[model samples]
Every structure is written in structure tokens, then in C-alpha cells.
Target: MTSRASRSGRWMERLNGEIEWHPSQAVTTMTDQAHSVASKLEQLLKAVANNPSLERQLKMATTASAICEVASSAGIELRPADVVKHYANRLLSASDEVSVQNFDLCSWDAGELLWAMKQWT
Candidate 1:
């Protein structure tokens, strides 16, 4: 009878140990998944930060000194965030024909600015 009780106690201990191990393993797997998700989010943020539309905005706003001054005053150094801000500023200031012409010159989709570049040459 004593041996049987001892064997039963040992089996229960082993089962508890196995159960504990699984939770720890699950915790580790969850941690790894969270790290992977965080890394992907960082990469996405960087890609958005380096978007090309921002560069196009800087190029268009810098087409004229007046526009460049406005862009510079807005603290946009041709970087992604600055490009967005500069574009927004230009759109807000787009009341006059000069502003409209400059905005068109800086259009991101169409290669219209190349015409101005050719004329400059």
C-alpha cells in the first residue's frame, strides 16, 4: 500500500511539472511574436517617413525662391515629414496665379516640371 501511494504522488508531481513547462513555453512563443510585430511596425513607420511624395513636394516648393522661403520657414528640409507640411502650406497659400503655377509645376504624378527644367536650360 505504501509503495502504491508513493507512486501515485510521483505521477501527480510529474504531471504538474509538464503542465508548468507548457505555460512557460507558451509565454516564450508569445514574446517572440510580439517582438516580430514590433519590428514590422518600425519598418512600416520608416517606409512612410521616407515616402517619395514628400520629396516631390520639396522639389515643387523649391522651384521658386518665394515658395522655398515659405517651405524653409515651415522647417521642411526636404525630408518626408517636411515635404507633407510644405505641400499643405503651398495648398493653403494657393490663392494667386503664381502659387497655382508653382503648385502645378511641382505636381507629383505628372512630369510637367520637366518642361520648366527644359526651359531653364
Candidate 2:
């Protein structure tokens, strides 16, 4: 075999090993995950809105991971990616006037956050 083909085969081997889901299941799995994350986001937002202690803890959280820790302690489900995606969606819908890089938020994964944003550009 050609050297390039040998390297390509090895790369494919590693890729297949690292990925668990079948190609047919990828979309359904991702959709389910998205719904689960959205549910957690809604739950966390409502909890924060209704509970002053939870709100305070969230506000005091220094990072998205910290916020997740706080929420988890309060029996709320939150993930760092969920926090990143939440802000991504907010910014995507926000007016262009609000793109200030002010330290108002905690975590950032803007480049990889939203697949839908690719449609906007």
C-alpha cells in the first residue's frame, strides 16, 4: 500500500474508535441531547428567577463551570456547553449594538457554539 493510504487507514481507525454512535443515529442522538440541554436551561432559568438564593449563586459564579457547579449543588442540571450555547443563542438574536466584549458573561465557545449561526453569515 502507498504510505499516504497507510496513514489514512490509521487515521480512520482512530476516528472510528473514538466515535461511539452509528452514522444513522447521530442526528437523532444530537436532537435528543439538544432537547435535554434546552430543558435544563429552562429549568435553571426558572429556578434562578423564582429563588433568590439560586439567583445570587448564579450571579456570584465566576465562570460557566462555576455556575454549573452552583446549579448542580442546587439540584439543577447544567453543563458548560449549555452555558456557552445559551449565550451564543442570545447573542445571535441580540441587536448588533450589543456585541460588546464586556465581562458580563462567563464562558465562551462562540466559534463552535451554534451550527445555525453558519446560516446567518
Estimate, for each residue in 1-121, the C-alpha lDDT of model 2 and write its tens digit. 5799899999999998999877989878766776787788778778788889888988888778988987796687778987777666566657666745432353547765466578768
Model 2 per-residue lDDT at 60:
89
Residue 21 error, candidate 1, Å: 6.9
- Model 1 residue runs over 4 Å out of place are 3-5, 12-21, 53-121
lDDT by residue for model 1 (7-46), tens: 9999999899878466678878756755554454344335
What is the lDDT, from 0 to 100, of the residue 92 in candidate 2? Answer: 69
Error of 1 at 64 (Å): 40
Candidate that would win on TM-score: 2
Worst 10 residues of 1 by lDDT: 74-83
TM-score of 1: 0.31
Tell me which residue pairs clash in candidate 1: none
If scored against the real structure, what TM-score would every candidate get?
A: 0.31, 0.51
